[model samples]
Target: MDIFLIILAFVTLLIALVGSIVPALPGVPLAYLSLWLGRWSGYTPFSDTFMWIMAGVTLAVFLADYFLPPLIVKKLGGSKAATWGSILGMILGMIFTPIGMLLGMLLGAFLGEIMYAKRSGYMALKAAMGTFLGFLLGTGLKLLLCFYVLYELVSTWWATGFGGF
Candidate 1:
């Protein structure tokens, strides 16, 4: 049971780390789940209170990541079309992966502003830049959280050992 939990925890941690940058996966949430798996594996690196706190933090980060880009588009004078376009582009972009997602966001914001909002090129570009900034901010925050969780899990594994393996 312990071995199974440890393996599951490690695999999920790795995927969460990748997803932190990928934007398609629910990175922070997975990282939080790995912490629980680690606990169930008999490792006590963090207390229950700490885990609960982390759960709330993880949810906040996830929400921010999901909403920040569209909010930024709107804040930068982009129309609702641009906001919706950015969201759609991100989902479609997931097919190509990490870089595609960003490019797609920029293009989506730009095209939406151009075609629907009837904004000038420079204005559209500005909105796209804002969206890009939001993406960076969200990704960086998730990456930080995922790395921290990964570190704690690894430390727990190291300190506790694999049941004398």
Candidate 2:
């Protein structure tokens, strides 16, 4: 059962890595959950202090993904409609392809600024840029966190002889 759980933990970590980029999954939280699974499996992969710290960090990162982009948009003079359009685009963008989310977000923000916000073309572009930059920043942060967690998990397992699997 330990071995099975360890394997499941690894699998979840892998999905978290993919989720870092996909935007559909909450990557950082899932990675933290994987670490907890390892702890629950009796591997004791992290210290109590480390676990608490990671929990806080994971929650922060998860919230950042939601708050960062909108903050950036607003700072750059984006309207509420622009934020909603970007979100809608992200959902609709999932239909065509993974990269479509980025593009859809860009388009949606532009349209929102122009139509709803009554912003000029240059201003719309600026707001769209803010949204794009925010998304990229959030994704990058998630990827880094997930990769570090994955390394910790795999390395710990390897050090323990792969838990005798």
Candidate 3:
């Protein structure tokens, strides 16, 4: 049963890693769940205080991930329309995977700035670039956190003799 649980935790962590990029999955939450599962499975290396701190970080990162791109668009002189369009594009882009999502965001921001906001081409392009940069940053942050959590889990397991698995 311990071995089974350890395997399950590892699988959950792997899924969490993938979720960090997929947009639909709550990657940070899933990764946190893995830690919880590990704790329940007799891996008590992580204290409650540590878990709570991680939970807070996860929530902050999750919320920031969604808002960062739009905020960047706005910061780059994009209008509300551009911001909304970028967010909508990102959500819709989930259907097409990575490339589609990236392109959708860029196109959406550009069109929104040009057509809806009546911004000049150069300004629209700048906003789109900002959106793209924000997306990359958000993705990077989430991936980093996910990997950190995974590392913590694995290191703890290793330190504890693989959790007896």
Candidate 4:
């Protein structure tokens, strides 16, 4: 039974960690939950400090990941329409293909710009680029957070004697 609990905790952590980057999955909270389970298991490998830091990273990344894209698009001179359109495009992208979604963001922004400035392909392109950059940065940040949390988990476990290292 104890062994089963440990296994369950580890599996949950794995799923949460994976979810953190795959847009289709809820990442931060899942990662957080995994850590919580580890601590609750009373056999966590990490010191309290490590777990807290990992949680903090998860929270930060979660906030940034959800907000950066729109902010980036807006900063690039995208109107509200462009920003919203890019957001929709990104959501759609998850259902389609990553590349397709990225392209959709650019096209969506372009279309948004066109609604206001038809024939200004150059300006629309700039807006699309902003959306893309934002999306890229957000993803990178999320991935980094995910890795940080995973590392903490492993380190905590290792320090606790899981690997005999």
What is the TM-score of each predicted model, taking all chains together? 0.89, 0.94, 0.88, 0.79
Best by TM-score: 2
Higher-ranked by TM-score: 3 or 4:
3
What does candidate 1's lDDT look like per residue over 1-165, in tens digits?
887887898899889988887766778889998999989888646788898899899999999998886787778877777776676777778789767877887888788888988999998888888877888888898999988887888777788875446
Candidate 4 TM-score, true structure as reference: 0.79
> lDDT of each prediction vs. the true structure?
0.82, 0.86, 0.83, 0.71
Candidate 4 per-residue lDDT over residues 50-132, each given as its tens digit: 77787777778888988887788778777666776776776776677777777777777778777855537777888888878
- In terms of lDDT, the poorest run of 10 residues in model 3 is 81-90
Superposed Cα deviation of residue 124, candidate 3 (Å): 1.0
Q: Report residue 116 deviation for candidate 2 (angstroms).
A: 0.5
Order of the predicted models by lDDT, top scorer first: 2, 3, 1, 4
Name the Cα RMSD for model 4: 3.0
Clashes (backbone N, CA, C under 3 Å), per candidate, total: 0, 0, 0, 2
Q: How much is 122 displaced in model 4, in angstroms?
A: 1.4
Error of 4 at 41 (Å): 2.3
Positional deviation of 44 in candidate 1, in angstroms? 3.6
Q: List candidate 4 stretches off by more than 4 Å.
A: 22-24, 116-119, 163-165
What's the lDDT of the predicted structure labeled candidate 4?
0.71
Candidate 4 clashes between residue pairs 3 or more apart in a chain or in different chains: 45-156, 46-156
